[model samples]
Target chain A: AAGMAAPRRLKPLHHVAVSGGTHGNEMSGVYLVKHWLRDRSFAATPFLSNLRAVEKCVRYVGRDLNRTFTAEFLSSAETEDEPYEVGRAREINQTYGPKGSAQAFDFMFDLHNTTANMGTCLIMDSEESLLPMHMCHYIQTHYTQSSCPIYLYKLPGEESYSIDSVAKTGLALELGPQPQGVLKANLFAEMRALMACALDFIELFNTGTVFPAFKTEAYKITGRVDYPRYPDGEISAMVHPKLQDKDFFPLNPEDPIFQPFSGEEILYEGDSTIYPAFINEAAYYEKKVAFVKMEKRTFSIPGLHTLSLSPSP
Target chain B: MTSCFVIHEAPVRRVAIFGGTHGNELSGVFLVKHWQENGAEIQRTGLEVRPFITNPRAVKKCTRYIDCDLNRVFDTANLGRQTTEDIPYEVRRAQEINHVFGPKDSDDAYDLIFDLHNTTSNMGGTLILENSRNNFTIQMFHYIKNALAPECCPVFLIEHPNLKYATTRSIAKHPVGVEVGPQPQGVVRADILDKMRKIIKHGLDFVHIFNEGKEFPPCTIEVYKIIEKVDYPRNKNGEITAVIHPCLQDQDWQPLNNGDPIFLTMDGETITYEGDSTVYPTFVNEAAYYEKKQAFVKTVKVKLTAKCIRSLLP
Candidate 1:
């Protein structure tokens, strides 16, 4: 029983990657990674994900690059008719992932920014993942200037689709309230600090420091809420002005959520209270998501340690 | 011919072009700078075109303003206030601007004022007028409308009785707001800038033609008249919990139906419009208006007929 309760030791990360510019208009990540490449300040391999979109200063040249990383798209044979993002996804998968494999990069950090005022958010693939959880825990406990919220994007057994999913273990660092195509100096600095902290955590873990078990809070995605639409598929309503920048805030049932053109207030009819993130995100409007609803859960993670290279006594 | 109102006005010789009213809006900030350096593009045979940046301090910092909104500081209440050592920066600037281009409703004021602006909303090139009934303004609106693509520019009228507007343009007898957008604050897009340039060119040309004794015939044109403004829903702590419904975003100048959705709450609830009649919305999600506690302004589409205008010079 004592042996079964022992801390789990995992393989040390050898190759870590940091990617940016998956959505071109997100200027913080795009410029941060570019600065890193030019300065050679950070040791991690800096990858600029979408060159064409970055040059154009648009979200993407073809389809959204972040959404183009599913198995169906990655494994499909390359053809002349394939979209630019699809081809890029395949190349990225080949370079970093071939995901869920031993040869895949140990960790990948994808940087993103939202027009929504989400502040600093860390998006993890699963609630149970140990390394990313430890990294997020480290960031939350140590980065005292601002509160960093952890968001669990994947449900149990769900397939991964985002660009960060290419690596074995990954997290998407999202910061915002900054508009697309514009760089806010404060946000850029925050992103840089967060990235440095994450890298420090990786170095610490690599040096074989054991991370203790702890309980932390995270918002898990439940379902997506789309904007109300007309019969012709045109969106009929907008994100309520009340919810414009209240990302990660508790939203109660029967609260005023939307204000239509008629100036009437719309109330939430859900039975349970929920916390929403990405409220009024500019990019999500085109994707039909008014906001992503989330359920707050407290997670207790087990202590983690790097695999012992020496023979056990 | 049927009944028509003919307008005869003294030559519109002194025209002032104001930019950087809200310093973060870059299209006007840069355009005004360009025209101030080289006057050939905006110059006319008989008119003295003065392109000025209203808030240079704010422009230097690339912010909206130093204290309060410069655009809202031009009202008589603020302008007539005693100059104190501790007054807000914009109030002083407004007074200085008034002293140069206006004294607000004085006969010595400039003949016409073209104040440039930008919005975060998807409203295309828009001409805003305080007095929708004025013959010269209506003729200018009609002329600019005829010159540019109809879908690119629309006229919006904010009915402010008693000349109570706080805008910089309100100082002049005839004020035309050349507002364009879908631009994010602090950022400039070539497409948006080019569209603004075209609108200004057409405006200058219209004035040039009018000064040369050309008469504009009476015509009926579609204009959006401001009805009211709605505020965002807030909690006890004043935190917002919803966003502009996706449907309503970027749908500026489009007719908003009674049952259409206008907002979506954070908890994924849909909010529908309950108005009895359809209305058009402008300045939807304007970045500058967020601080003013307004989500969007509603307007009803109406046809405005302008009288025939012949310059008093001829």
Candidate 2:
């Protein structure tokens, strides 16, 4: 989108915030916001999260806008007036949230894309949220054409920091294999479909249409794995052909994971088979992450209290 | 270390170096500054080297350019036009550069031009952006590639689909040098600088050899020949929504097949390469190109032959 219009103040029966461009270069949400901004009939208070970054086509000018949403970070906003993102983060919070407080969005859709082959996945801050889990299950079942996977990225002990984490109830829509600053038509349509589906779910929820109980499969984050490095800490190897682009696939023990410049294949010594995603993600190079491993578990949606009642998940 | 000077050393007439064409690319700015301060250390017999920072305002601001990209404003038409207050900063700079050392088609112009640039792409130590008539540039690259390690001498020859040479290098009667890195903007890496220094030294030596009556062998080198540019997946709003696929990340110079995965959605769907044949990619996820909205460029790997390297010598 050429220009970013400010978010419109809307008074919906249930205030739902649909955001794109939290990481400005990620374009699906950016264009969606731009398009909706031009005509707001379909948009329920559309928010173009990081306008400057969208125009510059960078992730952010300073720190990541998506990663600046934690309560602690928001509380100490004015203490360090350095990066441009901190002020923008506060502006977004004041506009849509101030989350966990009384005046906040009833629901939020934080759109994102990944270098990872994670498919049309729903990323949540907590797995214990009933409404989000139900929404994820509904979207996965309906959005069959798209590779929809659910991931509980934020664990038990982690603080919520993403744009979605700021909403009273929100899930970040993660799409991928598209490069930052570039958008694809097929994927764009898929994201649009998911958004419409999410809006429909919210509508149904408000209308008291109880979603039928269903089992949903999700990937649970365990730990981040970095590239095989030399003693000097330089990455000594790259993702092997077998392991490269195999996001959400089972990574077996003793599998050839890295191919060193010396032509030697490095194996996974861990005994348990773990599913890996975000393999060789461009953004993760700075983070030193080669991939992130997760555990796969099937849990039924709407388990009364939204707790995993079908044994340990 | 493999070859020795025969001592029939004839002086190199003139060579020009350009840096800070894009101010945000720090390696070029810093390297030129270092050379301007202490180029005498690398000084060899006969070659008269001149170094200049092409865009001072951009360099001072730590931006790619001030008014417009200096690299794109170097066409003869733009340079030949009389300067006006209405012209952009880069246009005026190009005119100044042309005045100093150009009318590049002329015989008195700089013998070889080294236009230094850095990128956020994983283009290790690339030499020569593709110019079909520049056989001399390729000869210098051949010498450097054989002399250096693989990481220090990767070849990425970009052939623009429609436009002919418009970069700062195009201003040179004969051009050579690199667009290097995996380095961020406004950042400098010593290792990359070291690589650039080696290439420059070897290039100077090659010129020395060329000036002498010594004949060099006919040569061929494999080059990733850039054919076309691929933009990131966009919505109807023309905004990009995907990141470089993990399969394709840091895969510069690697072969991409017909059905190879090129992009991944945030939702995890794989967007595949629909090309008919396998092609190599370069400038993969280049930071500067992000503003230009280019994800990466596709290239055909080719064996470029110097039909007669020695025959060019008079």
Best by lDDT: 1
The TM-score of candidate 1 is 0.57
Docking class of 2: incorrect
In terms of TM-score, which candidate is strongest? 2
A157-232: candidate 1 lDDT, tens digit per residue: 7788998788889899999877766554467778888998998898899898989888899999998887666576
**Cand. 2 TM to true fold:** 0.61
DockQ score for candidate 1: 0.05
For every candidate, what share of the true interface contacts is present? 0.06, 0.00
Model 2 misplacement above 4 A: A1-13, A229-236, A261-263, A303-313, B1-132, B135-314
**How many backbone clashes can be found in candidate 2?**
39
Q: Judged by DockQ cut-offs, is candidate 1 incorrect, acceptable, medium or high?
A: incorrect
The window of 10 residues in a row where model 2 chain A has the poorest summed lDDT is A4-13
Compose the digit string of candidate 2's lDDT tens values, residues A1-313: 4233322222222788888888887777787776677675874778888888887866788888888887766776375656788888888888888878778877888888875667787888656777888778878777778667888887668888888666687888878866565555556777889998888877766554545556778899999888777575645565776786688999999998886534478999888999998876756655778888899998755432222224544
lDDT of each: 0.82, 0.74
* Tens digits of lDDT, candidate 2, B71-175: 887776887777777989888988888778776677666667888888767778888655754566667788888888554477767666683358777766677
